[model samples]
Target: MHLNYAHATRFNPPCPPSQYAGIGLGPRMKSAERFAGHRQDLARKVHEAGIKNPQVLQAIATVPRHSFVDAGLHARAYEDSALPIGHQQTISKPSVVARMIELLHKNKQPLGKVLEIGTGCGYQAAVLSLLAQEVYSIERVRALHDLARTKLRPFRIANLRLIYGDGIRGLPQAAPFDGIILAAAGLGVPDPLLDQLAIGGRLIAPVSKSETEQQLLLIERVSSHRYQRTALDEVFFVPLQS
Candidate 1:
């Protein structure tokens, strides 16, 4: 049950497990050694990689990484590499996921609501589910949604609304998020994301290109239709799929 809701919402409450147990993660299965090992690895890697947010670290640790991927790849579950989660999408590397979360909350304020632009593999969405008060996640692929919804069955996250659409457009009706995170890279920063960020809120993503890898950009919504952009670091990711 604890592992089951890792993808649904970011709520810190405990939830019951779903009986389906797709990919062998259910009541009948126990991956204690694997889970514990991944927990320790995440602790070391996240800290080594400079993830300063304790809450984010705990959320990453608590959410079972293995359950979101192909069960056959269980052995590589904790590796600091991205694995395919179908629809040609891969879960962002654990470090990348944690870093983005840390970047989103760098200003040290309470986030009222969050908009997650890409829900690939649902790993990033799961992490956001635990940290933000509310999450509006958009997934370009449909099959991923079905998988994520089922995996999130056991979590107490009630504030997340998953939508299947273009990651570039974002969720308009639920705009004005306190924080925004884009999981896929795209050429230039998407205007819709900036438009949706609430004042004093931050948006993090890679300002993308075709030939060059994108740089991690942190934009703060200073006023309506205005933002302050700061370059965080260089990052590589799948191009944002519309």
Candidate 2:
């Protein structure tokens, strides 16, 4: 079913899949064959990187990473590195994606409705689709937002909603999310996002301590006004923008 949540009117829905056909994806490079081999290899690498969740591994393996990257760079799609998707942003590395999603799934109960900030090429949202009942992704850059909408439409992901807006503002109209993930790094977790979390919800993002250093931060809302924060591995990401 299509998600007509409270924030549905904030942005236009993605176009129908039919309109996305034949968009030039550059030279075809045997993506299906390469994806099959690379997906399995990436899954194995992610497992070794401490993401033990079987479902997370499967999602990583099932989604085509090459489909989310530039056709010219499809050859490196399976590599454990982030690739630029224009606009100074990069699709996060496979290991980071798997670990973050695995952390979200580790919450006390399964995730129902999840919010993802920075849709990028929509790869993370697609991965989240496999885990959450519904996924709401917001992107601040209109170009990237429009690109993601087109690139993702063919997938026909019904439970996913892509919105063009400031990621730091958070989507309060659809507040009380089961989990929230931020793809960009910020000095601190945005208060608006913390306020939007459900009582027992979890939020994951990269937190910057200085201009050059960052750490993967996970915050859990235990009570209405109380949150516990934990620092995970060091990581790098573009700064979160308003």
lDDT of each: 0.71, 0.81
- Worst window of 10 by summed lDDT in candidate 2: 17-26
Q: Tens digit of lDDT per residue, candidate 1, span 1-242?
A: 23322233232322211222222233423654447767778767877888878877777776778777888988888887889887777888898888988988764533468888877767677677666666677776778877777655544345556776776876666677889888888777777777778899889988774567688989988887678988888888878767
TM per model? 0.83, 0.87
After superposition on all CA atoms, what RMSD does each candidate show versus the true structure? Answer: 5.6, 5.1
Pull out the clashing pairs in model 2.
Answer: none
Question: Which regions of candidate 2 deviate over 4 angstroms?
Answer: 1-34, 107-110
State the displacement of the C-alpha of residue 219, model 2, in Å, after optimal TM-score superposition: 0.6
Question: After superposing candidate 1, which stretches have Cα over 4 Å from the reference?
Answer: 1-34, 107-110
Model 2 per-residue lDDT at 223: 98
Q: In candidate 2, what are the lDDT values of residues 122-179, reduced to their tens digit?
A: 8998888777776789998989988788767666666678888887988877777989
